[model samples]
Target chain A: MTVGNTTTQRSADATATGAAVEIDQVAVRFRTKKKDVTALRDVSVRIEPGEFVAIVGASGCGKSTLLKLVSGLLRPSSGQVRLHGEDVRGPRRDIGYVFQRAALLDWRTARRNILLQAEMRGMPRAQARQRVDELIAMTGLTGFEDAYPNELSGGMQQRVALCRALLHRPPVLLMDEPFGALDALTREQMNVELRRIWRETGTTVLLVTHSIAEAVYLANRVIVMTPRPGTVAEVIDVDLPVERDYGQTMSAPEFARATGRIRDLLGATTTAE
Target chain B: MAAQSTIEQPERTAPAGATASATRRPGGAGAGLLRFARNTWRPAAVLAAILVVWWLVTAADLVKPYLVPSPGTTLDVVLAQPGYFAHHTWITTYETVLGFAIAIVVGVLSAVVMVYSPTVEKSLYPLLLFAQVIPKIAIAPLFIVWLGFGLSPKVVVAVLMAFFPIVISTVTGMKSIDPEMLQLSATMGAGPAQTFRKIRFPAALPHLFAGLKVAATMAVTGAVVGEFVGANEGLGYVILQANGNLDTPTLFAGLIIMSLLGVLLFVVVELLEYLVLPWQASRRTDATTTTL
Candidate 1:
């Protein structure tokens, strides 16, 4: 725990936790009025402990559906999603989920919103208070504890949302396009912040993003997914250095190559669609 | 053309910081008063103009005084017999408040039930609709027959009149929660009760208040309607009594008092809304201004 000090060194004192994910040939078919639409087909990917993985694809390519499956919000039509070698039968308290929208309760202030995790999990009040303070500082939301979600900016609201998600120090953090709604500049800033937090907390992150560049910029490995009946198209390693800068990372050759490859995969899918 | 260009340019200029500044600008009590005055003045001026026109028509003897009393005559009646109206107003207010309370509790609980259980909703939705379709005024006399012409029938009528809007708005509010938020709550491992308290109920408040404001005014109408059917006291009774005696001024005085009661109740609801949902109201203003 040192807050806002961007470093690659892991917190040895940080709670020993990282949820490894194994997607075993999972396929999801949603039965709607019109048809039994297959969202994912044979999507098998094993994420290592403490790894930051980004899944990127065109809209409707089951990127979010895959995240849902892992988070136990949805069960696959076939196969299984396992966390830390344990089957995900239902929503696991050990995993944190961040939605696309900040989804902050409009009535709750930033501090109250962050404390929601403690309230839900019934964490000891004093300890949860200490954790919330640290998280608020880490997320750069120190002065905005009393500010309502509507009072905060889009980026600030998302920061509160992130704080709420991480307050419980969950082993796995699943994000579904968390910064997709933000503008380009804010989104980039959030990316840097997210990377710093990930580095500090050492929590395993499974991020679903539509932006190819974003996927490369944050994740250790980018899982490119195909359109419609989405499965892993390619698992491209982001071969950039671990110590990354938002402005400098984009210009790195490896970054360019990784993003470029993901872009082509996405482009191919759109044409096929 | 200039306005359109200005609007287009703000998209480039309106950063997240703009909203913070916008809220901070309205800082002091003076600014608040100014804002209130700015909003209120136009309607106040229109009302004044209408009164002036009304006074002129009456001064010119355009209508028979017996048929429609002059504003001055009505005001005089209100002033001269303050005790007469006060007693009736008190009775009506009590009935309205009690009925409104009943409507709110029943309506909200029903809304929660409907939202949580589809089977209950499927079973009761048609019956709820049927209740709404029946003219409450037509059944007011029936309530009087069943419950007698005391506060009971009046309260029942008020509840009938006020229930629908509260139920409808609450249902909409409860259901209006972003699906993603619910999913996030689920993934947070919140039990159903915790999720409802933390997310669903708070989200529903703005919509509930909208319904409450409507129901508050309707409650007064319901109370008065019940009195109109059968009552010994209340503004409704006064109006009916005045009409029987052809005392037009007293009738107009009763009308004014009833309207005042409705306005007063509506204002109270609005104040409660401001207290409960400062975030919601402020957000709307910020959203509109940021577009500019």
Candidate 2:
């Protein structure tokens, strides 16, 4: 874990970018009415600047919990989560999050939804408007800026959610299966769009997903976790080309091999448990 | 294969033919207007039928005239002795508006406090429930005794009658937000106050409006009941006076006016809801278009 941290920091510094996040021996437990359930145990991961890392696990593997811990929405029962080497006792403004559901306020238009995050951060209206315009154009939402969430398709609403997450230009983006609710074809298209956006913005992204192909295709490295009292099972370096086209990459040998290995790891863990 | 071909052919041809036929209808705007009228005309016709039935029932003396007077006689009473009920109606309207405004302010403030402090909610919620459960009419006389008969007693009665729904509704609205949304806001480093203002408040608006609509209708009834208890002015006082004299037409006239006021207030609330939630309207319109 120490070696991993140094490598992460060295690489982060070498790239002239600061260490974005560090999670040191983090553990989370939930006390229900009946019993205490351990969600994550002895999980340590360091996400370097500009790295796209995907955390992949089956249900009950605490993947979402890990995302929450890093985003500072939940504190680890033990260990520490740090942003830029500073302890994250609570949520930080430098990290943006997108949920599986769009979760757009039904009453607000797409433009207003984007403005919400900006407003919460106390950005002036003039600055917010400029950021909103850039995001709308970047997300291809120029024509539908005034449309409400209910007026949009599931895919479009998710795009709006993505734009909202990007509005503040956070150094780290935490996404928990943002495309999970979308249809298969739309989800695939969203994956392609997300990769494009991530590359363009050079933002470090920590995404949690159940799809092995999705994790393998998007991440520079995929962290696999064990189920129930989840710990990092293995961290596999994805050797596929960084710049990817969805259709072409899926058929590439490297992509298939990476996906197959992650799938086998997941299967082995599931069967063992 | 042959049957499948026949089935598939019509499936393709029917939609194409239908589209062609629809486009061939040159007066599309007129047809659209005709469709609109056809839809609206049914409800209008039903209302007319209801009015006719009501007039006939009253005209034929199917029910006691004292209970259900003829529409003409009620109208005549309204026109000739309009001043008789006017003062009372104005008084009731004033009480309703004033009490309703106070209820809104107090209810919203309480809701904010309750949401911010569980202790406040825990302590006050049961008391509110107990107050709500009490028969407001039974307390009307007590209010008159305590506050006197000028306007204070009546307004207090109106407030008591209409306060519960607003508070309960506002509290529920303030608390009922998506957990994920709260999480999102929290992760964005938003504090409690920011969370409430930016996320929870806007999200709870539909629920708040729902409570307001119910409260508005109740306000009218509250004012009338308050007037009935002990007041020299207001529609309720006039109705009570008419009843004492056995002037059935005048009583019916007052009742009709009160009913109209209630309907008018409800419509105003609905109109406000429509204005405040235009996004809801657009969504509804979208749903209709998609269904069509």
Candidate 3:
């Protein structure tokens, strides 16, 4: 509680003002000719700017649906999603999205791939290049600006994606299991890099993952979701220092408490959706 | 120490993938020869066996002299009349090349149109299928009758023969783009044009070149079919004349020359693929070979 950082200070400030993202009683359903599938229902979350929120759920939980709502990639059957207090009507241009796969353009170099966000937004060339340099440096992708996605490692590709997402410096970032595809050690290393990047950039992030420990370690608050016709089962506040060391944070009581509570919540609902 | 390790730790991931790929990659000169032989020896031996049988069938006079002709006789026929054969080959090559260029433009444009408009796809898909499924030989006479015995009929036949492969391959390529990429690009504020240009178009190149290579061979056959029906000048005309006059050596020479044209165009498309898609060719080439 005594540890102070700009990330923590800005997080506190964001709560007093407008929320960065507000998912109000959102429900999403997909209908086919033969059947109707309810993806999510009665889901609500309020994410403060500069806050890290992780939604932990098993496959088919619609934790990913929650992110789609915020990004305006999907619409809820009911309720509403708002970004920066504005209702999301269509695909919102003011946000960045990272997927499990880095989704880097195979033909493009890492720098050019990152610049895609800028080019799409019509950002000034010199300004976009300058911002790209900053992100490349921040992500430790300095020397590999010219490498294609195929030439890069899984972790490096994800870093390029992270840089691309943060290029516009949007107020909110949405990640769908951004580190899920990496190996265990690489995933941990990415988790640490992501935390540092999040602190440095101070962008509000909504991350969806299946890993309980990942949610507890990287997020200020964890939203545990139930499977199929998913809804928020519980919200866990990880009462740990804003600046977390991998070894220290993993061993912290708060981390264990948060993870334990989430495991129990997910475990009980295993038999039914 | 933590900060120093952070920089170094991420780089460790790089070497793991690099080394794994290195093991799969074609090896040094000595190892490469072994792998090359493994992948290619069967095809080489099969071709050699066919050539020997062809020579024996002629040498033993199992067939009439004018019916099969010796391989040496066919070679002499080509060597004796280089200018005459060259003129006919040039005509066919020109017609096929022109038709192939047109096919690429039309094929790609139509594919783009079809992908963007479901209505266009629905309307044109059946016609495209029919074009591909129909025997070009059966329809060659129709094109010749409609356009007459000249460059126009031969070129038209070549276009019809070649364009379907390009269309199908190009459509598959454009549609094969990861849907997630489209969503991500949409979130980035890319409009349809921007998405197609940056995400869809470049992603489709490797497939498009693949289509072009297939189309290259088809175009040559189409041109020859056109000549088979009606032509004043071309390798097909040479072959037709030889067949009528029972000049088996000329007939064999014409067939070889036409096949060489197809191979030449195929090689050209391959070279273009390498130049245009430097990123894909290395990985793409490796996946095609069965080294074991």
TM-score for candidate 1, please give it. Answer: 0.88
The backbone clash count of each candidate, in order, is 0, 2, 0
**Model 1: residues with Cα > 4 Å off, grouped in runs:** A1-19, A268-273, B1-45, B287-292
Task: Please write out the lDDT profile of model 1 over residues B1-292, one tens digit for every residue.
Answer: 0011111111121243324422433222344344445666787799899889988888899999888778999899989978988999999999999999999999999999999999999998899999999998899989989999789999999999999999999999999999988888887778899889889998899999999999999999999999999999999999999999999999988998899899889878876765556666566666767898
Residue B209 accuracy (lDDT) in model 3 = 88
User: Cα deviation in Å at residue B199, candidate 1?
Assistant: 1.3
lDDT of 2 by residue, A62-117 (tens): 99999888888789999878887778887777888999998999887778898889
* Clashing pairs in model 1, backbone N/Cα/C closer than 3 A: none
Pairs clashing in candidate 3? none
CA displacement after TM-score superposition, residue B162 of candidate 3 (Å): 0.8
**lDDT of model 2 at position B26:** 15
Q: What is candidate 1's TM-score for chain B alone?
A: 0.87
The ten-residue window of minimal lDDT in model 1 chain B covers: B1-10
DockQ scores for all predicted structures: 0.31, 0.27, 0.36
- Summarize candidate 2's per-residue lDDT along B41-64 as a digit string, tens digits: 776798789778979999888999
Ranking, DockQ, top scorer first: 3, 1, 2
Docking class of 1: acceptable
